[model samples]
Target: MTDQSAPDERGAPRLTTREAAELLGVKPETVYAYVSRGQLSSARAAGGRGSTFDADEVRALARRSGRRDTSPAGSDLAFRTGITLIEGDRCFFRGVDATELARRYSYEEVAEWLWTGELRPGARFTAAAGTLAAARRTVGALPAHSGSTDRLRVAVTAAAATDPLRFDLSPEAVLSSARSLIPTLVGALPTLGDPEEAGGGSLARELWSRLTAEPADAPSLAVLNAALALLIDHDLAASTLAARVAASARAHPYAVVSAGLGVLEGPLHGAASGLAHRMLREAVDRGSAVPVVADHLRTGRRVPGLGHRLYRGEDPRATALFALLEDVPQAAGALAAAREVVGTTARHAPLHANIDLALAVLSVSRGMPADAGETVFAVSRTAGWIAHALEEYGERPLRIRPSGQYTGPRPPQPLPGLRTTP
Candidate 1:
């Protein structure tokens, strides 16, 4: 913690390590553990405060921890990232709490910060008229029932074709491309609601109307916006890695985003939310989580959205989403069902809900189609992929190549002859 020796920027009353432990009836070491779990927030030392926690938050976490235990996360990736940190149950973007960042900024603001490491308050992204028209024209050629990701892939390609400077990979050039392409990706989609609503103030508001015909309420719209911000980046996720590899080979920014999009729908990658959406819908349909969860276990199928490889406790994104979701009247049943799913599954393991489940809850509550979570993921992850591309662009060309440890037949085996007609 930095020794600012000043009041916390948030102005919350702070507690020192010993004071917090005494209040929580735990050791100072356990106090640090609480920060790691993200159950508590800490601030730099100031006014002889040393490192401290918000008094009210620590009290709340103390009450909660008395009821259930959270396990510390186990494994971590070796890849270095200045963009995000997945520590224990929490995520941080350049050391700022991502959940908190989402609560405070628009998705466009978050994406801008990720790309340039500078906060631009009230930043807005707008696509050029020609590019939007071209992208929409290309996407219009697809079947009416085309999936969101498919439409997006086509839209990106068309946008690329229209950009005369796509080959100019300078940082300024790439940032300009991203600022246009992101909005274009949204604008290209056929609006399912009022065109005026889809033509909006914040990117999240614009995206909401494209996603569903339902009217956008302030509370629910806030949730959507926060989801987008929270998902701006993860440390070297599969799709981000793919984007970096492409960038390392000098691909243009649009192509880097396309490469990321290509890897997003795989089962082991970004498709978990779709599965979770389906499962949540079933549970909501049956009006109970019991049978749905039991059936998965009985069939030997893992319950979707229950746990995450990246976290051993709760997903902080889910925790934040659930907090915001509490204010949305339409989300009550879906949120309850999500909690039930977690409660039902936790009897057997330390499994806890992840961001996929949070997104599933959002989609299910908003009356979006089953794959809507995937759509949200793809759009949000575009920012992350581009961030990775920017980082890779600064590294040595093709620097990610790794030699294979062959476990196949010995290398000295004689080469087989070319086969004649068999």
Candidate 2:
């Protein structure tokens, strides 16, 4: 082995085979074995004669090998992300409190922050005319009964197919595509009024027209903006993970968003708001919240939008959005219904209102479609999915694959006729 203490031209320390072996408490040959088994990486020596291993990789491998536990059940595959964090009842986006961000910033500003880690107050969010036109045509082709989220999926797929630059995986290109994609997605959905009336403006104003025929009022617009900001990012959520998995395979940003949407359509994720909306509608129709809550509980089913897996207290996003709806005349009935349901649950369980509850209330109060909340969730979460995809693009590909533990029947011996001859 060459000099063990030598540094590469970049001034980083690299260990020789023997030195790495010694540090790992193994023979030099064993060090080569580790490299062969993909446990370590090596580079050529300064003289270009011998191989030198990365000191950090060797040390990490040594530590991993020295651990006694090898069971997969006790270990987990986790991807580190700098996007968002949920601690207790609080949520943060890159160390900034999300509630505060929601209160102070528009959804566009917040989404820009999440994607680029910088707040550009003057940035514009607009899609190409051609892309928007294509998306609208695609949305129009879908069945009239299609949900907002289904239209969104169709739009994204169409957008991906139309954009020749989508395959560009660079951070700058991906972010630009995302900025355009979001607006096009909101614009493509069937609106309740003349499309021209929903002219260029904030995302909330644009989305408001799609969800309702009512004019854009300040209180309702603020609630919509806050909802978008608060929902922008949540660390490694199922949909976000799906986006990251596609990103890990080097899929385009539109395709990454598509992957996330596929997962978000599940009842347990984005569609939770639809169920909550139904619950609130039942309460409104029954003229009593207690009965609805009790009936839902009696059925051995969870109260949709009542509890969150990550929050021990109330969900902060729920609190923030609900606060915005407190005094609106349209929201009064829904607010009362939510209070009754919450009060009833408080007596027996520690369940608290989550973001889905707030979203459901927003939909009911504004007289939006039952699936409007899910649409908001899907659109807002697209920003997060893009952020995660950007992060995953910088990582080594195929790193998210997880090993599975087999717990089924043992492998059977091949039948005489089925066996292949050597």
Candidate 3:
């Protein structure tokens, strides 16, 4: 830690070695351990402040100790077996165009496409509707006004827990997983199982209506369906990677689904929907999104729903999704204003709305609660997870361990009465 004797231009005082070590909960020896390991950089005081270290470097020391740095994932250069591809601008479920599927297909149709890679002729949309209906019923049976994420999480965990066909990771079983998982995690209102009836057309419309209290008009529903199509898959995200890895390990469908959900719980992947919503809300509050973005840039903030690492140009999906939301009035003004701000203030390229931003627009315009948006996204993305898992199941087993560059002392024998430690 550096001294707090003088504040920097940012008006934050520097930290001291002891204070930084204390914050890291490591002894001074371990702090030196980090220094010796070339993990933490230390600098002598320039103006009476003691040796200062980068705050993130100190945190890296903590992460290295725990081995929980599961991020910065490896690229699958050697393996082409675990990925699925969508070839065109038009969204395709399996191989069926999503726009066509959206008009004529049920949610189950989309689930089948995701799991089986084929939208068969005469496919029934609600073959597994009973299971989803049961899951929704289970969620509705929970205590009133509970956090929807928690409730959905618990309900999904339990549904997977109780599933008898979970270990059958066959195409049909994977499709069944999607069908059951989506409606259960979404649909805020209760839905009873209707074995003889499949939720199609108007039934699909009703499900969309039940997802939010806001009236589902043409624009909002179209935008939401488009967002669902857009987010249904991406090329090997961490959560998608986790799902594939689990399937590669020969884990069953439920295990793969659980593993995917677990990855989604991380901030980098699944938590983005909530953050995007918050950013939109901030943009709305400030009246002009450009100034808000300028303020954020001035303060060293990263724009949440703007740029992506993979797509250097504008995200094509964002443009397509925004077009779908053209008539959505609720948050349309804010989105439009933010886009205008992006054009004026951004230096790299004007901001491009990501899937998170699109989902945020759909959720806000439909009046779904802020918390429910993520649940809906998760439910939708189960398609991609199942697809990736299916792709992995066909490949060789995955062993994802990396070599460690050791920096510790050699092993030593213990004396008598010394307790063994892990």
- Candidate 3 lands at a TM-score of 0.67
Q: Name the candidate, 2 or 3, with the larger TM-score value.
A: 2
Give the per-residue lDDT digits (tens) of candidate 3, residues 278-364. Answer: 766677766767776676678987766666655665566677767767777786775676575456556755656666776666665
lDDT of each: 0.84, 0.85, 0.61
lDDT of 2 by residue, 1-422 (tens): 46445786778888988788788777776666555535577887666777888887777666555622232322213435778877657999988999999999999999999988999995668988999999999999998889999999999988887899999999989998999999999989988965776887898889998988777789989999999999888887889888988998899999999999999999999999999999998898788899998998899888888988788888999999889998577898998898888989899899999999998888888888888888999999999999999988987777666557779877795565766789
Model 1 RMSD in angstroms: 10.8
Task: Write candidate 1's Cα lDDT for 1-422 as tens digits.
Answer: 43332336676567788778778777777677666534567876755545777777777656544522333222111233579877767899988899989999999999988988899998999999999999999999999889899999999999999999999988999999999999999998888877889875899998998888899999989999999998888887889888988998999999999999999989766788999999999999999998999999999999998777778888899899999999999999999999999999988777999888998888998888877778778889999988888877886676555444568997788989998997
How many clashing pairs does model 3 include?
5
Model 2, position 408, has a per-residue lDDT of 82
The local distance difference test score of model 2 is: 0.85
- Per-residue lDDT value at 392 in model 2: 85
TM-score of each: 0.80, 0.81, 0.67
Q: Which residue pairs overlap in candidate 1's backbone? A: 5-46, 5-47, 6-46
The alpha-carbon deviation from the true structure for residue 1 of candidate 2, after best TM-score superposition, in angstroms, is 22
lDDT of 1: 0.84
In candidate 3 the C-alpha lDDT for residue 354 amounts to 67
